[model samples]
Target: MITLDARKEKVGDLLRVSFQTQIKFFLSNTKTKAAKSVIYNYIDIFTKDVEIINLMKEYEAQTNKKLAITLPSEEVPSRDAWVNSSIIFDSRT
Candidate 1:
């Protein structure tokens, strides 16, 4: 059987975007019905910066998910720290 490299899996950006979008949707819909909205859970996020880790905690509190954001020893800060640092994201984009 041919084996693919697991290290090549770079889906952090995708997961982060999905998580932010879903949480935003749930919060915005509070005026109407939020129970129907999906609260993402069991998400595993890997990062290095402590700031991002804290931010993820806030997101977790809002979504109440079993999300896990790990900080690998070899991980480095994201290139676009300014934008990626913020948890508030526009769902339109």
Candidate 2:
């Protein structure tokens, strides 16, 4: 189950692309080191994505121009913060 929090328009697009990559990772039977590396990379990308949105908002406010971005909600639910936020993945099934 994926709960996507509302994000800036451009940021949302990038997230969608990243989600596709994540799906690929899920389909593969990779484990441990490689999996952890991919997860870290995804986190890095997501952090940067939010940063870009924030910078754009600041620039728009300073310049008095409309950037046409859908900003995230003020009270973002923790469950929607990431793709696997509330999921439990167990290999010893």
Candidate 3:
């Protein structure tokens, strides 16, 4: 029998993005059926740099564990900072 144990490494702060999305769908039958329309809006995301960094710092201090940050790989081209940071991708990739 063999037992293996590996320690995790520390990571850096994550880069959060702020975005907005709006969607609308409609369906209608002009001859006999009624019409229906669905609208989904007011979807947005925002994160403050200072606040996020502060939170990350606090978490690291309390947990004493490495923080693994995540970022979108494609967005790297748009965000220069991601160029030097790890892409922290998931299985979806």
| TM-score against native, each model | 0.31, 0.27, 0.27
Per-residue lDDT of model 2, residues 1-93, tens digit only = 533344444554666466535534543543333433444444433433554444434444444655443435574433224444222223354
- The deviation in Å at residue 38 for candidate 2 is 1.6
**10 residues in a row with least lDDT, candidate 3:** 35-44
**How many steric overlaps are in each model, in order?**
0, 0, 0
Q: Score each candidate by Cα lDDT.
A: 0.42, 0.44, 0.28
Report the lDDT tens digits of candidate 1 across residue range 1-93.
533234223445555556556656555555212322222231223333443445446556656764543445585655333233333334467
Ranking by lDDT: 2, 1, 3
Indicate the residue-level lDDT of 16 in model 1: 54
Residues 49-79, model 3: lDDT tens digits: 4444454454445446444555464542322
Higher-lDDT candidate of 1 and 3: 1
For candidate 3, give the lDDT of residue 80: 29
Task: Please give the RMSD to the true structure for each candidate, in Å.
Answer: 12.2, 15.3, 20.0
| Residue pair clashes in candidate 3 | none
Query: Candidate 1 has what TM-score?
Result: 0.31
For model 3, state the Cα shift of residue 64 in Å.
0.2
lDDT of 1: 0.42
Best-fitting candidate, measured by TM-score? 1
